[model samples]
Target: MYQRYHPDKNANDPKAADMFKEVTFSYNILSDPDKRRQYDSAGFEAVESDNQELELDLSSLGAVNTMFAALFSKLGVPIKTTVSASVLEEALNGLVTIRPLPLGHYVSKRVEKQCAHFYSVTITEEEARAGFVCRVQSSDKSKFKLLYFDQEDNGGLSLALQEDSAKTGKVTSAGMFFLGFPVYRLDQTMNSIAAAKDPDTSFFRKLDGFQPCELNELKAGTHVFAVYGDNFFKSANYTIEALCAAPFSEEKENLRSIEAQILSKRAEISKFEAEYREVLAQFSEMTSRYAHEIQSIDELLKHRNEIHASYTITPFKRSTSKSRSKSSSKENKEDGQTREKRSTRDRPKKKKWYNIHLRVDKRKAC
Candidate 1:
């Protein structure tokens, strides 16, 4: 029907031209087995890269007739047609199976590059509500483990992504391991680095030899991705993909306990600070009051010294005034006695004249 309805044959219909091109494009890819396989497996983009145009011959309409006959049979119609036209090219994944392969076959070939690796892991809300495990491994047989903490985990992934983009190729794995690119919590010194870089740190109870590097009860979002490797390993291949998930009750409880402890500590610190300030204020007030008291005592002591000096001089002054008064009284008594004796000597002559007159009267009487 493509040739019967093609715009070249039916020149008035522009819509039929579009249908003709579509039929030709499909035939170009489907007719070629190589292009058909490429289209089926990898999609149209692979076949389009070939960049071939298909020629539809009006004379050789046998295959086109057969194809329409089959399609119309399925649609309960009987039609066969072809078009004389050229096919144009155009461009545009599916099921994955998990089967266990022998370790020696697929494992040894998996090698790590000498660059910092960045991985974006998406966990669904359900996956985060339940806990998930992400497995990491190294190609260089490096021993290491993952450390999970709120403040530190996201920082590791960011640093690795930055370093991977900045480096020309990659530094040697030795340099990466030594510099602690993925941020191992374990020691990496010469003596202890060997034992400290234990690969499996997580402990599982029921499963034998089970280790769980799990993100337990994470908040629903994109989480931190990081890897830690041995300081001396040449190269290490690591995976940051979620493996499995399970519901976690203990994790929520642990978070609550930690939060309570933090709050308790903060309260204690605030209480201590308040008490310290109160004590400091009290000490300052006491110091000021005692200082004023000391000053008052000093002034009182000065006044007592002045009073003591005046008292010392006062006794001497009293004794000197008493001795001068005693001497003056004795001189005044001596002067009075001398004046009385002079008066008595001047009165004896008058007494003798009166006695002579009286003696003359007495001789007459005798």
Candidate 2:
């Protein structure tokens, strides 16, 4: 159920750590010229490239790797060898584990560009948000619960119904994956570069965008709206239970569990961030310390590019083709009605209520 790349990185970038994380994030392989041709020819085994399934279960990375090795061996493709480098190890450190979200009638779309409901938000502010934005309204008194957690499961925090707009929104359940997201997580990647030009949200498209929602324009207190879609009318309206992560902070123990785990993990990440910063500082220092060395983001990128071009892989077996497969392999069951591609519900369910069970790690107060 994990969507992973064969573990390939572009290998051309100067910063192995940053590039590997970006590549691994896409479930790709790290293919530098120094690695196996089998890795390069085969490329990534795209999981429909619709990462809507569950997060990659982090605990299972080795198991997942073994599974892929078996799958690729069966498919006649072997993983690249550079997968063993420090860059990959670092990226895998952040690899998340999620169950595969189903691909049914659910349609997925990312927010290419969204103007605020009001004008106080500027383009710079919107860019900083780096989040998905969508609105789901249900009028049937059916409640909508929103959940948030880290990209990985290693963190023990899962938050339920954390609507910023609501103060007393109850924390009904934590670790309840099924009741939330009902179909798909918000697509945060800017999928269509062309979409940047058309920044309007029609009723049809807005219902489809599953990014994080914002209630900033509304009154500080609670307000009512209909959460729509998924068999409510021609669509449905769900009564939103709360707004952001602000609704529930009463369970101090769970909060502590979340904070502790995140801090522990952040400590590791912070270590790396510090190293990255130190290396950068050293490079700058070296640029001056050693008169011959060049220093700049551009110069470093070029230097990184040259290293990969000349590197060579041993024990090579080359393949002759590339493939980009889509969920089209799984046909829709209904001709008229779209197949259910994703459900925020952890599993397929007949029950309708969002049983949210989650706790979020507390960040340092800004």
Candidate 3:
């Protein structure tokens, strides 16, 4: 490049003190192989990372405001600002801005006054995909039907849709879009900006009265439909939008999410029901055991030959020796019977204690 310096120029006047001089400074231009290769292959977005503050042209800024004012005239706004040359200069300085995206309208297919095919664009505060282009989709793209034509073949289908449409298969599209690359030819480096036609292209400039030839192939992101003819072609770029089913698809997504929540809640209720069934089964087992214990206690209480505090003793004489011997046998038999009766009473009393504990649950009081 060059170096900056002050040179001696004035002799007497203070106004002509030392004048600025241009010094030729030698600089070796260097390019890294990795970065150079990436820049060559990447899309329009690749270079924007380093260009934080895009260069502003005063004239282009004025043009953007002029276009906005023309549009607002039909918008029926209550207040309008008067445009002064000085105010325009301030607007051009960056008070108002043309974002990466812009306000767009649907290109009317009415070719009587307007272009035959045009783009219907929805404007919002969002960065548009650079080089965003669309092509006419065919009606019956069963097999890959390749079609291409230049200005020589001015043939284009009216894009007729089918009867059972929107369910399956490509319905006819009413518009056309840039099927090729979307490189912008705006020379922001200069003050003037326009959609530079191919005449300005280097190769097209050299040719006189030349018709451009384009090659159409199945690319990665191209949309497709089927047409009856193998070849029907027109060269001018056209854009249109198909009416998507029920606008605001984001709302539909919210409904789907609500349905999912309902299903999840139902699953939780089912799980609770299953857990309740398990608890009921455990309660049933406990109830069956309590019933068996109650039956055992009932049998013990109803035993006919036993009663509490009653001694079983047979009657016998207390005087004669033979009678006394008989009395001893009677006494032995009575003691054995009494002992058996007492043990039964004590064991059955445990069943009563079990019943008491079984009825101790709070629900039993209720």
Off by over 4 Å in 1: 1-127, 132-252, 265-276, 314-366
- Candidate 2, overall lDDT? 0.31
Worst 10 residues of 3 by lDDT: 20-29
Q: Which candidate has the top score in lDDT?
A: 1
Q: What TM-score would each prediction reach against the true structure?
A: 0.25, 0.17, 0.17
User: Model 3, stretches more than 4 Å misplaced?
Assistant: 1-254, 266-274, 304-306, 309-366
lDDT of 1 by residue, 277-347 (tens): 68979999999999999999999999998888785643567788889999999999999999999999887
Candidate 2 regions with alpha-carbon error over 4 angstroms: 1-222, 225-252, 273-366
Error of 1 at 68 (Å): 81
TM-score of 1: 0.25
* Most TM-score-accurate candidate: 1
Q: Higher-lDDT candidate among 1 and 3?
A: 1
Model 3, range 1-366, lDDT digits (tens) per residue? 101211122223222111110000000001224444555688334443422212211122345433432232223211112222332333334232221211232222221111122122332222122212223433432111111211112322222221101112544332222223211111121211111222133222222212222321223221322211111122222223332213434544564465456556656755666776689789999999999999999988877446642554754345676887898999999999999999888874335554664535776755
How much lDDT does each candidate structure score?
A: 0.40, 0.31, 0.31
